[model samples]
Target: MTASTSHRETTTADGRLSRYPVFLRVWASQSAGAVADQLLPVAFALYAVQRGAGAGTIAVILAGRAIALVVCLLAGGILADRVSRPRILFTADVLRAATVLGALLTLNRLPLAALGIVTALSGAAEAMSRPAMRSLIPALLPTGLLERGNALVAAVQRSATLIGALVGAAIVAAIGIRAAMGLASLLFATGAVAVLGVRDSVAGARTRTGVLADAAAGVKAIRRRPWVVAVMTAVAIQLFAGTAPTMTLLPLVATEQLGGELGYGLVLAALATGALPAIALASRWRPRRPGVVGMLALSSYAALPASLALALPLPVTAICFVIGGFAVELYFVYWLSALQRQIPAEVLGKTLALDQLSAFALLPLGYALAGPAIAAFGVQPTLLAAAGLTAAASVAALLVPGVATFSDPVGTKSDPAGG
Candidate 1:
């Protein structure tokens, strides 16, 4: 049967989720962990600044964390496919808690290098949790409700980011960064406790192959699915060309065109605000051609760069950011839902790791290059180029075979092991 017909058939009787208690507990666990993830970075940055770390040192610390996360992600994926996912989640949260509290207690007397190492460990813990978390959803919800479940998860994550940033700033201002870090540690512990209530084991069939061989199996799985490669390629391009440049330039644009930091904060808040409604829309809307619709929505992200490039008014720019945020989140919900529904359970974690790795791999390079590109080519030209590249990638993704349906009709098989 065609994918559209299959999707339509599954729509009935799955509207109301029956296994909601398990899902809710998992969601709560994820929420706590997500908030802590955001809280730590802000609190750590403030604490580092108070310790007299220069911008270069702070950049190094952030880079270390990113690198650690990237390095550990594949191992995390391999382990996730091998062990109980809930156990992985619990262990990851405990590690994060230990890392934060350990840094606070011991690293204060040492150089900031020690603190950076601790945060890098925490980032690795986060990397370990992500693929397990994403891969666990199919175990919690049936195929029909997977999209809504993913939409809700995406919404919570985005909300946690805004809440965490605001709360981190407030807590640091009120009680200091040390106290904020303590609270973040508590949050991670809370996540650890919460995830223990999730009854689903959510472990796939354990492969006896070595890590390299297992990793190669994941690559083979991806090669079997052309749509996965197509969407991931488009996402990689979007992040590298569009997202990295926009992030590098947004603050500068706000300062020059708007009124500096306050305006920058306002633009960011507006952007975040736009995603809530988009997520709500995603929960109720299930498109027949999810990949095509998602990529088209992703193309709308070009609006923000275009607005900034044209030196638009602050209100206009903020509006553009809102639209861009809305589109991106809409795309994200659908794309993630597609992954959960399409990828085989056995290799899902590895595929997710690869997807995440591809997205993060080019980000540092893009961020590093954005400044030089801006200086050499000037800001407007650079921003315009980002917009064009984002649009082009999104459109190009639609041409790949199987992308329209987001699945290969003949290649995919049922999970015999019930992973």
Candidate 2:
């Protein structure tokens, strides 16, 4: 069947699943992929240490994944837009499976440098897969369901994060690193099969253009839309300057204040646990003004650092993290909905890619800076500074002329499919 016909058949309003089947298939695949992604790093890091690799060598291994993300992102975006998103996703999954298998087979014999190279290849495959998955959501669901769809995606991801961490650690402990990696390969293969089962409509024919031009057009579309541009800019700054500190540096805080890695994991898990309820509730409730909601949600970050600085017990710290996680999830649901509704179908892949790239581009710098900043001053003060920056970014979004007032563009527009 043609892609368009398949989409139409799957989108009936009164179906038993009510738009959830699509969400489930995508979520399951993504969750499996997330587990593999998390498992590889932990296993690889352990392998490196066991091999007597120094801190610098391990860092290089981790850094290779980040470097691949940066380099392949734009091209991935272009490919996502130019071809079938499902096809791209499946191909990326296959590549990821191969990389993991290679790692598993070569684990004991390969040098750290060679392993890093393999990990980098896996990272590139992941980079390609992410944008394609994001672009597929709008195609699979009705307009009113967009927020819920995004919420479902976010909630599943957070749950996966919790599960993946635990499962990964268990896998590493039970089997050797190579065996753990083999499990990751299985997960990726399963994800590929699930993605292949997803049904989507064919996008309209796109104009032929150079990669640079395609990328530029995607950027230009965002620039031309005041609300899109404003939200993207605000998120980029908030993620890089404010949110990263809490997330990336919290382990440091756990070590300094609570004594070690166990403390860090507990705090992190607390945050993820907190987000679960938010995601569950959000799937049923759609915010009227997403732009305004996003701004408000972001402002919640300011409280986390201030509370942590007070030297509260673990329970109190967990509560603070939960509140922060809830707020972040609220903002994220709106952000995802806004993009699905505003961006044109033909260019959605490229646009989503650009959005992902801009938001994550400074993360490496944020990670690198967190250690030095905390060392120079102190964890509490550093966190407070990060919170302040997040607040500033939120306030900046509120100042944008139309950002606070922007609504779902898809709601009022006629369906492209003429349902």
Candidate 3:
């Protein structure tokens, strides 16, 4: 059967994802997994502190995981296309659980090198799960509901992240790091069980290409699509220039200008709070030119850097953060939903991986550069530059041929679901 036909068959006639048992299972699995994913890192960091590791040691352990995730994401994408995505999800959760369990047992007794290896394993498992989780959505939901489904997924993930981080810290503070790690392991195992109920569907026709060729093919697919390249470029610029500097400077701003940790926490809470309404709106709104609208929305993030650069009052800066958060959620919901529909199923996993890779690969470099840039040029100049570049990239991306509507000029109107 065609991919479209398969999607329709799996979904209910009303196109409500909630009515589909398999989709519910997939959703449950993701919620559990998302919480576990957030919880583990926090717990690990706290555990390291409890074991008397210094900031440098903690940073190294965390960096190992982040580096491993970047290095392994492509392989995860390739495997998702070839293997059963549900199985990949299941395996990833199990592996994560094992890694957390390992940390729980050896965190104090083991050397830092051993802890780093454990974190790396957790990161690799996280990388494997991501592409599979996203690609599997198309298999469960109909075309008409893909946007809504994506919105729900985003909402769950964002909420889980906030909840997981708070809960992880709380648990660690209350009962110590071991209890937190134990809970994280249980959450991962629970996610694994939840995913077992999801129906397995192959994402694409099997390919016999060698691994290197498979990776190259994902690249070629992007080069063939001008819109994909444009959007990826825009997103990469947003993460690198806009997000990195904002993150680096926000803490300093909070300490010097605002109260302190409380102000920083409040600002972050506002950012996340703003996303809730945007997520709800995304579930219902279908803009005619999603690409154009989404890109414009993405430009709203400039408010955040501008707020920090001006050292706006705590309340005002927090409001700008709320706007930034709203813009990001709205933009990504449209962007990802459009991509799921536009890209051919055979290469969807790889394409999504490339999208993520482009956005994330520059982040570490951006973070590293942010402090140095601020040190040299001052925070105001550096932050304003980031804001300007973010806006410029978003506007420029619109000039690309397919980006205005996120579709080929020759065929976009023919799409029955519109943008």
lDDT of each: 0.76, 0.69, 0.77
lDDT of 2 at 197: 61
Better of 1 and 2 by lDDT: 1
Residue runs of model 3 more than 4 Å from their true location after superposition: 1-13, 40-66, 109-120, 169-179, 203-205, 249-263, 411-419
Q: What is the TM-score of each candidate against the true structure?
A: 0.84, 0.81, 0.84
Candidate that scores best on lDDT: 3
Full ranking by lDDT: 3, 1, 2
Error of 1 at 215 (Å): 0.9
Q: What lDDT does model 3 reach?
A: 0.77
| lDDT minimum window of 10 residues, candidate 1 | 1-10
lDDT (tens digit, per residue) of candidate 1 on 54-127: 44445445555666766888888888778888888999999999988887787548677566687679989988
For 186-210, candidate 2 gives per-residue lDDT tens digits of 9889888888766555544655678
Predicted structure 1, TM vs. truth:
0.84
RMSD of each: 4.3, 5.0, 4.3
> How many angstroms is residue 116 displaced in model 3 relative to the true structure, after the best TM-score fit?
6.8
Candidate 1 root-mean-square deviation in Å: 4.3
